[model samples]
Target: MNPGLPFLPQNEPSGHEDEGEPTQTPNLEVKLAGEPALTVAEYVSLRTEILKLIELQAQLLSLALLSLGALLGVAVQQRNSNIAFVYPVLALILSFSWLNHAHAIHRCARYLVEAVEPASGGALGWERFVRQHPLPFGMLGYWGVRSVFMGSSLVATLVGWSLPHPTLLTVIAGVASSLLTLAAFVLFLVWRESSPKQLKVEGHPGSTA
Candidate 1:
């Protein structure tokens, strides 16, 4: 034996050693952003209100279409082809109004699907219910309503073109309708593009988590 036992090797501090610090869990604050977390009942009620709004939009569209038809019929009976331009003008207005309402309905439905359903954690089925029982009218969905209006208007315009006594007013009507339709479509595109990528759920200020 040299001195005490051979020289003992000393323990070395390793770079990978964990310092006895407490681990932290990630913040899982699942919130609806601008909107407060709503109860299941509140979600359901809001969904119902949206559905009612969609129904009202449909009813208003129907009334507008009926009025347009009546106006056309009266104009024809009175042999007033000079007022032919007025028909397209009215159609443009009605179509724009209808599309605006449709957009509102779409926004509400999207909120229900994206926010409401997710928060429900499989408890809410309002999205499915709305799909199963859609709003009244031939309106099946977003594209369906848009197509219906565009298609019907095209047919009506073509028919008007074939009418007797095509005057300057007729041409003016045709041009105005086409321009307004284009304008409305452009505006819709702008609105969709300018809309926030994230959905902001409007909620009471007190509900912020």
Candidate 2:
């Protein structure tokens, strides 16, 4: 027998050679092709601030919509009392709604920017991230809604001034209100329809299956 080889005197080895040892995995390093930038808290805080702004604006727009609905109810009852004033009130509310929508959109855009900043030359590309956050699409929908409201309010104001007959103006206003309602419903439907479903995936290291 070779000197290097161990000679089996009589019995075979008791332990299984196949079970000598389990394989070991080498350590892996995951790196992006870029430089490190912001501190964790800073990054988180920035994202939090942006999301908070979006939430605040969303609440504000919701309040405006609610107030507009209430004012519309009051206007319907008080026909002879120059219901045109309600239009101006709603106009003011719509202004605030528009501003809030724009603000929310801006913040959502900023958050998106921060998210992709590490990737390359600051671009989010066309991805669910823009929609995934929820705020961006919400703001966009609200923004479109506020535009419709603003137009309705303006037309009501002008029609009230020109046409002294509340009867005919009432018909026009009703049509505008109906159209606005339909517009809001449709925009909501589109946004909901376009949104993608999220899937949950689970994984574990060293899993055989």
Candidate 3:
């Protein structure tokens, strides 16, 4: 046994043992190769932040849906389609905010998988496992939420068109809103579909952990 590995038992030669035989101890240090530089505490902090962002993402989506319903209700009650214009602008802002949160979440998760897990000797492998085995209907749920926003924007455009004398500004705004919403949805899909290996290479911006 090596003196450096105190826990390992020392080997003693017996009468039947060959004189040329050598005792062997496991090379535990090899496991440390290619390990990341992050500390355990940093990994924990990053994970906590990611959990909070997920909760925030859900809340933002709820708010977007509720706001849409309320705006549509008021437009219908007043018989004024002009109010529908507000939904697109509001939805655009909300969608951008949602995307920000989503991007941050993705960045952090990628960091955890590429950096922290290796350092911890596979003890922290949840992120890596998730990447390998994604949940069913995950993309479907993503598209569903985006569809709700896009569909509502289209409805708002139709409402604007229903007016007896729709102004050019209203028509332009409605069209722009629809286009912007569709663009946002497509951008989100592209970001999500990007390879994790590419993200790791790019590294996260403004990430302290």
Candidate 4:
């Protein structure tokens, strides 16, 4: 047992070797202020969820790019200006969903670092380590996705506007797409600015376990 992790209960020998019985260790408990205690197993489960969300983010981006390519290809081949309008709507929906996933990932990681890791007496320090040392161009993935969605929407809008004798519906779609893209960009910026910084975890007085 790590002495730093006082919340983790110490294991004792059951002395059941003569009886050929296996000993059971108690689950490590983490108590947070005004919250129920969480077991180490639960912490592991949360970490697993974060991993899944990250993978889902990549899949969503790939889906958006693939859909954009297919839609644009078909629209160009048929020379149908109306089909081009669909790309903007698709970009808005998929990009917004991806943003939501990113927000969730950020929230979960913040909780792990700020609340759970501190409660565990810094025994669970992966989150802290990550905050202290981020990769170079770590944000490029986010920016790339944002650029792709926004660019695709703008292109779709322009395609609609370029149509000879464009209808009111086409104009409306173009306007709506531009507005949605702008709104999504603003939300993403707000989220990035609101990210919490890493906090220092103080050691408990005279705590040695």
Ranking by lDDT: 3, 4, 1, 2
Highest-lDDT candidate:
3
Per-residue alpha-carbon lDDT of candidate 1 for residues 1-209, written as tens digits (9 for 90 to 100): 12354443233445433665432223223454323446566686777877787787677568657756775676567655434435555656666676676567667776776677777776776664554444454224544555444544554455455566457866777676566556545544454311211222122223332
Per-model lDDT? 0.55, 0.47, 0.68, 0.67
lDDT (tens digit, per residue) of candidate 2 on 128-192: 24433445346565446555555555555554444444476665665564455454444444433
* Displacement of the residue 137 alpha carbon in candidate 4, Å: 2.1
Question: Which residue ranges in model 2 land beyond 4 Å of their true spot?
Answer: 1-38, 93-101, 104-108, 111-116, 119-143, 151-209
Clashing pairs in 3: none
Candidate 4 similarity to native, TM-score: 0.67
lDDT of 3 by residue, 1-209 (tens): 34697776566755544566544545554445324444577788998999998898788788878888888788777866667767877776777777788789888988888878787877778877776655565567657766665676667666755754357776676667667667656656665533443433344544432
Q: Assess the local accuracy of residue 97 in candidate 4 as a C-alpha lDDT between 0 and 100.
A: 83
Clashes of 3: 0
lDDT digits (tens) for residues 12-119 of candidate 4: 645765687744434322233323345455568779999999899889878877887887788777766677777777787887787788778877877887778877
Model 4 collision count: 0
Deviating ranges (above 4 Å) for candidate 4: 1-39, 163-165, 191-209
Off by over 4 Å in 3: 1-38, 163-169, 189-209
